[model samples]
Target: MSIKVFLKRVLIITMIILIIISALYIFQDKQRFTKKTGTINFSTKTEEKNILVNKNGEWENFFVKGVNLGASKPGYFPNEYGVTKEDYLRWFNLIAEMNANTIRVYTILKPEFYEALYEFNKDRENPLYIIHGMWVNDNSIEETMNAYDDRIIKNMKRDITSLIDVVHGNAYIPQNSTHASGKYKYDISQYVLGFILGIEWEGYFVYGTDLFNEEITSYDGEYLKLEEGTPFEAFLAQVGDYAVEYESEKYEEQRIIAFANWPPTDPLIQPYEPEDYNDIAQIDVDKIKGTEKFETGMFASYHIYPNYPNFLNMEPEYTEFIDDEGKNNSYRAYLKKINNHHEIPVIVTEFGVPSSRGIAHFDSTRGFDQGNLSENEQAEIIPELYEDIVKENMAGAIVFSWQDEWFKTSWNTNDLIDTERTAYWLDEQTNEQFYGLLSFDTGEEHVKSYPDGNFSEWENSKAIINDDEAKLYMDSDESYIYFKLNIKDLDLENDSVYIPIDVTPNSGAYKSSLFGLEFDRGVDFIIEIKGKENSRVYIHDYYDYLRYRAKSLPSIQKFTEERTKDMDNFNYIYQYLMENVDIYIKETKQKLIKDEQIFESGKLIYGNGNPNSDEYNSLADFFIVGDEIEIRIPWQLLNFYDPSKQKVAGDYCVEGLNPKPIRISKIYSGINVKRGEELVYSSNLQSYSWKEWNTPSYHERLKPAYYSVQKMFEDE
Candidate 1:
């Protein structure tokens, strides 16, 4: 054999060895990339009293620190679902940054939401989980007076199917007026932690459904069964079974399941509570148990706000219960009771206080009222609520909302405003609209004015009444109508200022008989600044909201009449008072009285209204500095049904006490000086108008509560 031929063979062997080594390295590199970017097969299940998640091939307890994400912007309704993909992406980043491990959505959102979620979690080491929901049509249940009605049942079934399909990335729902609809191509079922079905059941609806269907007592399905339950509970069991069966058969996957419940419909018996509150209806989640086929388990989900239903405050056991801080915490007591009663893992899906200026409910013991709390106060109370839930051995807690929704209306103020146009402007006086950690503030770039007694923001504003006595400069944003009054020789201690504002073309009174004052134009509201403690807003008798409410109640129809025969009379806009009278419950055959009280609605507070001030009070209506007085009034306080369209309240007496949509192009205003019911001086009526805005200008800002919550969640 030749030496050259042997060398050639060795060279060929060396080249073959190099090729195999390079190919092996390339295969390993590809595997690494796929592990980083490929879809994760995340699995979650409920243990006896906790949620266990399969993380890095090991099952561990997953305490869900989550936030509820609503599909609404500053100028859109929830039904509209105007949230975009960019919005979802940005918000998801913020939520992850806040150390939130999960997000709970009320219903199926547009396809953009799923796409964003999939893209966001694809490459992250610790992906955020989701708890999707299926919304029920409450209008159908109320109108048909039967939960088993064909329309309601069919809609629920269809929604359940659609939710499953959307999460699996194979649904193409057509566009509809009510709910979101689009083609979903992103398979995000892996990250879905669970499914929360239905909404907060109305007590009457539950009772009526059971009464109407007396024979339908139990539900037996392939995955879930109810041995003995009410008609409503049977309905829930059937739905839960259908969801599990569909997911298992179609995709071979199973996750946790929960039905939305609250205090009014809870099964617990509270003898101290009113029969209507506790005994009228019951939704026992325990009755709906899962079968062996259902691999994942169920949990009890509730929307428990600290200050609601009056039972939380009135119950002796709850109010007297002490906490770790040695404080009487009715909220924690109620939570412990719920946790002890539930056999499954418990999750408070919705629980948080609103940082709003106006309040609808009050909590005497815990100070966690529905509203009337500052941002800092909200920041402090939320962490405490979470602590209570954790100490009670609960599974999880999700904050009520992620961002403020402008279209929300409260029970107390809903009758006075235009419900349709609520999203066009911000109403600080509405408690329900200000419940989020993210706030959408006014102005295209920055705030127009901050009623912090600073006059620099008003430099570019025009004066409506520039005269020798005073120069009144007016400005406005989506939240408030600002006024800067520069009066010569103004005296806050002795002199009183009366500002009468005409917001509508019709109604109002030419004279205020209460203050012994007359106006050049018919005015609907009057701003009387007597002193720091006595400042208040007075409304015309013909346009008062209490009269409208009185007309609706048959027992109090006589109160609807005008208090004074003279049309030119005005009265203080007192808050609508509620009193619990003795009512005999036919079922229990016992008479009971609930709690009630009155509040001064129109009273104005004097302090710094700027967000930058340490003493900032969101309820501050006016602040005085030297001879210049800066006043910022909420549009709703002036009886503006919809200020975006320049709409205000009309004469209820003539408009038949119903909502009369009245629009005005301009508002007339004037100022005058008085001393002890005597008019010292007056100015001519000045007209101010602004252009109607279809799309409101706003910027997103994270509230201080977000940081506090972030810290607490990170620590967890």
Candidate 2:
């Protein structure tokens, strides 16, 4: 055959193969979307033999693995912008892959959530179930624990009614709802497994309130009062009663209901127990008049943390039990005591630890603050906690969070007034921001990054250069920007690392430095370090600008050959340093106190510097572990605004100053090697350029559980 004819035949054959492959791919995609689980009626809630049955006809035993899904992230609000369909799709599928069947929301979410969930479950045999929460106005009752407060009660009732309406596929339009208007609507009640009534109540506020003795008649012809339980429990009962009427009236289906509680409302123990009550158990859930009277039952839910409320400090009777780790397992002891008191199924609604560096408080036996767990430690603790929950016969356990939330704060972080701590950056010391299965950007890259001179924790971080001889990696969380340098056979005596920073972004000004010889006037700060012994971090303006490269200065042209060499000549470099060192070098007044314990344990510890100290700890800390050196610089010391608080450019950002308290809006940084005053090697010589990109500054060691998350999206 002719050449053209042969080519045409080959093309035809390729087309035929492509058609077949396309058909196979389509078939696979359809199969992946098809559900494989059994389907049952879940339109109405039912109970048989004291076990709670879901609307789908599946019975929930003590095996509930779930996560708390919040709408707000560190700098983003899900309710205000509305959770994107893509996010819901990714999150729901991931949860399912983790072997979790349910998710609990703290409050009513935007319409997108409902729509995405409905679409996700469309034509599926087994769909992800939701435990919806009705958020109460905590501010109203915070000051006065009186559940009978007319405004709070009325608003709560209204919110409950509105939430029910939205779930029941009614036209319930919230005033500030985002992305709510749409042609598609769904009655998500079938997928809703239950409702969490309110957040963890401050039981102390209930002390003198009418919640204890004010007698009130329920709509169901049941009498209730504070005498039924503690003031807080009485409040929960009254609100729960209203929920029953609101939900039952709207939909014929019934669902599990529980009031959110923390250690404050715990029956096991309380750190601040009053004279009248030894524990939170005095506020009983079963004491409510309508609790057992109704067909659908109510259970108790507590946000339990192992390290909180000094569980080990409980009376010897409570702290007697010990776990395999040999630590006082008062956590289990507490759970057992509460389960024995309430006949109905009780659930640990929130339980998990945070992967943060800081410790709010450290118990002698327990170690650090409550929930301060490392990533690996947090992952390991989950299954163990689940086992305990199952052993105690609790209905289920939902991890406190699916991802870190930067917007949340801890008791200690609340008092910080620095601009960097203004909600933009992750506070590693604040354990609350690090408790998610998936890490999210807090003003910094991650919450807390340790510069313990080890680079193993930095594998997931973005590297500036990763050549065989040396590697430069950078990462940040909300509070600090960190850099790590790993070099082979590093010189400790004469060699040093130099960083030139352009604090202002892209202004196109250039300044020349004897050390940097850089081509930019925009360089605002320079940090020079030698081994782990001495370092200087100062504003670029600390140098007398007018005196730079002055003709009057004695010319040291003889040392030109020594400066161009790569290896450090300590003696020759020291000679040039003595001759040309006229610049006013303002060394940081901050001290570098070596911390061996923090480095060895791979933990972050924010040091206690004098509050009135004029010198900011810009290069806060550093350590040398092996051939690597890790450095941490606080954002505030560098004068960078907390990105979390920035809505647009020029909003609460740093404006560069002449000398101290240098304000930096943006910066470009680089490293250099030097021998005394001689520039042995400079990265600026290779490339004097700084570029900015859109990504969080902090770096987290843990990545999202991708396999598990992806598996959840599958039809099976």
Best by TM-score: 1
Candidate 1 weakest ten by summed lDDT: 33-42
How well is each residue in 512-565 modelled by candidate 2, as lDDT tens digits?
A: 434544533355455566655456455432221211223333333432444423
Q: Compose the digit string of candidate 1's lDDT tens values, residues 1-716.
A: 69999999999999999999999987874453234332223388888999999888899999999999998998899888799989999999999999999999989899999999999999998899999999988688789767888878778888999999899887789986446898887999989999999998888888888999989999999989999888989989998999998777666678999999999889887665654744578888988988878778999999988887767767778889889899999999999998899899999999899998778877757899888788888989999999998899999999988999999998777877888888889998888998899989898777888778888988877899988888887878788988888878888888898788888766667776677777788877888788899988777756676655543222323333454344564453544322222334435645444323435567777888777788877667899888888888888878888888888776676665566778888888889888666677788779888888879999998888899889999888
Best by lDDT: 1
Taken over the whole model, the C-alpha lDDT of each candidate is: 0.82, 0.54
**Residue runs of model 2 more than 4 Å from their true location after superposition:** 1-51, 54-62, 78-82, 143-145, 176-184, 211-227, 268-282, 289-293, 311-314, 324-327, 362-372, 417-423, 441-479, 484-716
After superposing candidate 1 on the true structure, give the runs of residues whose Cα lies further than 4 Å from its correct spot. Answer: 1-42, 275-279, 548-565, 569-596, 675-680
The C-alpha RMSD in Å for every predicted model, in order, reads: 9.0, 16.5
Clashes of each: 0, 30
Which pairs, if any, clash in model 1? none
Return the TM-score for candidate 1, rounded to 2 decimals: 0.89
